[model samples]
Target: MKNLNCKNCGGPMLIDPSGTTANCPFCGSKYVLDHRDTDYYRDFYERMRGFLHLSADGQERRRRADELWDSAASEVFECSDGRQIDIRSMHTYKNRIMTAYTARQNIIFRFDIGNEDKADRYRKNVSSIDYPSADTRSLSDFFPRISGGFELADATTLLVVKKREDEYPLRLFGTLSGRHTAWLIGRMENLCCVLEYNSIVHPEFGLDTLYIDPYDHQASLYGGWWSAVPNNTAVNGRICTTRDNLTALRETAAKVLGFESASAARETEDVPKPFADFLRSTPLSNAYEDFAYWDDVLIKSYGERRFINMETDDKQIYGKGQ
Candidate 1:
């Protein structure tokens, strides 16, 4: 009620009225309420108002967001090394909701290592590897250098933008509805990297994709087609790949280059007008431009024959050397 710090990790804490518990958003820990404090409920209620924009449109958007969250699967998922992880909803906000409303469709994953004893060590790893600490291979150097505004959010959340010039930095929304959340959980195991998971479902051509560094191309420089819509598909282009994360790196790549398809692949009919308005308000840049910029930079440094993952001729063949 006092905006007190989290007892477990000392991060900011918020009160959850439904559960009668105080929660730490930074570290998914909960604590019992001190019911003796009669003012606690009133204080929390006041605090929650700021968290929720209670205007008519805000209430409607909140309702829709709650529906999206309620629909999210509650089963816990196991990571690569078998750590049990759960998907928790932290906060939601509709950028600029208009008429017909749809759930926010982007998700920015910021992973936290939960080993209490190893907290310091995890921070070290995240700062040294996830951040660009003299490591050219760090995401900061890799994504921003390559193209697009693959900017790091809080040194961990990778805000995936179509072009480096897009002024509005897109936050990853948890609106993919199902398997994507599980995919993100598995991918974050033992890895301190940010990821952007998105799905554009429209009447014409829907798209689902996520972006991260190449699995084996650890040289610090980084990184799809479209399948027909499935029968009764809520979204189009159910692209698949070798990676279990369900990310469309192998397909639907218009976000990182200056290619024509990238421009053609707009979300006009697919998403709600509010999100489209939010996107339009920003200095929209195509993902191809970002890809092309990185391509040129990598080419200049690694030479004409450098192994770029996006190129057909330069593609990595898994077990085979590039």
Candidate 2:
């Protein structure tokens, strides 16, 4: 019930007791929880009216988000390993809503791993490598592999077997302005991160929503009947970045982002009215080479690329070292 969430996208979060650690969803990050005692929750909820209390607008925004989740995740995609998996939803988040109704269109990616033990190992901590590690290649490297999954994922959201999951302690990721993803940069205050996940719709019309617990860099896929509206689509360019490099660039990035810890969000006064769209999310379409775009301009690959099985450029027509 209580976890950190992306300040920019409002997905899910992981936080440390000091309330300094963070993680986020989608771009700006690629960048970058916990359970306490029951008694602690009782006392916490008893007095905290902060995010627990949602405004009418917030509730509505959540409903719309759920729809988007359904539209995206429900669609299936064929992975490089020859596994046919359904994204099941466009997007989903823990407990996030908006009062101003600022919905931002974003490209989202979902990936499922083949082994649970491997997943758990990756989930245990933020990797020293890149966020969503996938073998240290920038989102650019695997664009071909990710593009290959498009055949099975048409009209369905693009989900893959993240190439970097093998790089343990770095499986989960959220980027804030393309900065250092899992680590905190000096005094990293006034920063915000938003996390969101895809929703699922089954072949039988059953549905469920998933939420990430940044408490550790692990992705836990779950199912349930939830309501959601897909974020609308438009034309936009795809932006690619890595957390490590982004962190260095943000030495003066004005507004920087980090993952979520303890459901942190910006109050109305803290955020400007003009950029509300950046704070909100809309339904996403699977037609994209990636997820939803910022403005609908295509051709640019966003985030790290994915992997595919047989259809690989892995083939060297003339043999190795040719």
- Candidate number with greatest lDDT: 1
Model 1, residue 315: C-alpha shift (Å): 34
Candidate 1 C-alpha lDDT tens digits along 1-322: 1345578887656444332455675678878767653255544333322222223354654564464356343323354444543433223211111001112232223223322222232233223323323552444532322111121222222221121210111112212211121122223211212221121111111122223222222211111111212223443354421121112321122222111232233333222233222222321132233234433433433335433332222122122334
Residues 213-262 of candidate 2: C-alpha lDDT, one tens digit per residue: 22222222221111111223121342212221222212211223322311
TM-score of each: 0.19, 0.21
Q: Give the alpha-carbon lDDT of every model.
A: 0.29, 0.25
Clashes of 1: 24
Off by over 4 Å in 1: 1-57, 73-125, 129-322
